[model samples]
Each structure stands twice: as structure tokens, then as C-alpha cells.
Target: MSRKLLKLKGAFDLRPWYQRNDYLGWIMRAKRDATKVRRLQQMLDELRAGDAYMNMAWRPRR
Candidate 1:
């Protein structure tokens, strides 16, 4: 069986095995997006914690 090599932008080309495998691309993209989502969630949690602390600190004592 003959397979065409996919030319990559940098230097190396995609091997026949990778060229034939379709899910690898989707999995890579999903993993990247998942990482981004995790980072965003952590930042959001930090911001919320800071906001709550500021609110408590600004309250006047009776």
C-alpha cells in the first residue's frame, strides 16, 4: 500500500502511520483545549477567593 506523506510547516513530514491515523489530531486539539479550560477555572477560583476576602475585610466592625 502506498501512502502520501503530509508535509509539515517546520521541517519533518508526517509519517505514514500518523497520516493514516485520524483520531490523533482530534485528541491533540482536545487535550490542548482541556488544559486551557483547567487553567481558566483555576484563575476564576482564585479571583473569587480574593473578592470574598476583600469583602470581609472591608466590613465595618460593630
Candidate 2:
């Protein structure tokens, strides 16, 4: 489900390289499976919505 959303939006590709790495590293640092899942879900939601990043409003360049 997450992969589909990411792929559909080219989410990872569209973001700055450092942002992408930060997101993945943040998720990986989660000590609990639940936390990891929660972060991943949040990432997907932000990507699919096309309006936010890291829980903050973000409008992509046109």
C-alpha cells in the first residue's frame, strides 16, 4: 500500500535527496515496531495528500 502511494506520486524522487534519507533514517531509528509503522503511515499520508512533509504544510514547486 505504501509502495503504491509512493510510486504513484514519485514521492521519494520528488523530494530533496537529504529529506528522503532523513525520513528513512528516522523510521529506521524507531525502537518499536509500532512507532515505525506509525511513521511510515504518516509518510505515506503526507505523500498521497501532496500538501505536507514531516507534518508541516509544504507546497511543491510548480
Candidate 3:
């Protein structure tokens, strides 16, 4: 009976494994999107500065 109790205790004492790769994957995707947004903003700023009418050109003409 004591052996069975020891086995149970050993099972209960086991710690949960940490998921470092899952967290690292999320961080990498976030960094990628942030870089993409910065590049897009820079392009928009350049377009606006180069020509004021360029903003209107982006609108759909009907």
C-alpha cells in the first residue's frame, strides 16, 4: 500500500512543462507585423509628400 501511495505522490509532484517555443513563435509574428506596418507608413508618407493629388487618386472614380 505504501508503494502505491509513493507512485501516486510521484505522479502528483510532476511539474507541467513550459512551452517556450509557442511564446517565441507569437513574439516573432508580432515583430514581423510591426516591421511591415512601419514600412507601409513610410511609403504612405512619401506618397503624400510627393504629390497632394496622389491621395485623391487612391479613391474609386465612378
Model number with the top TM-score = 2
User: How does candidate 3 score on lDDT?
Assistant: 0.40
Q: Candidate 3: which stretches are off by over 4 Å?
A: 1-31, 51-62
Task: List runs of model 1 lying over 4 Å from the truth.
Answer: 1-31, 51-62
Put down candidate 1 lDDT per residue, 1-62, tens digits, no spaces.
22212222111222234422432443345457786566445433433343222123322124
Best by lDDT: 2
Least lDDT summed over 10 consecutive residues: which range in candidate 1? Answer: 4-13
Model 2: lDDT of residue 43: 84
Which pairs in model 1 have colliding backbones? none
Clashing pairs in model 2?
none
Candidate 3 local lDDT, 1-62, one digit each (tens) = 68755664443233122322432343455557886566445434533343222133332223
Output the TM-score of candidate 3: 0.32
In candidate 2, clashing pairs total 0
Residue pairs clashing, model 3? none
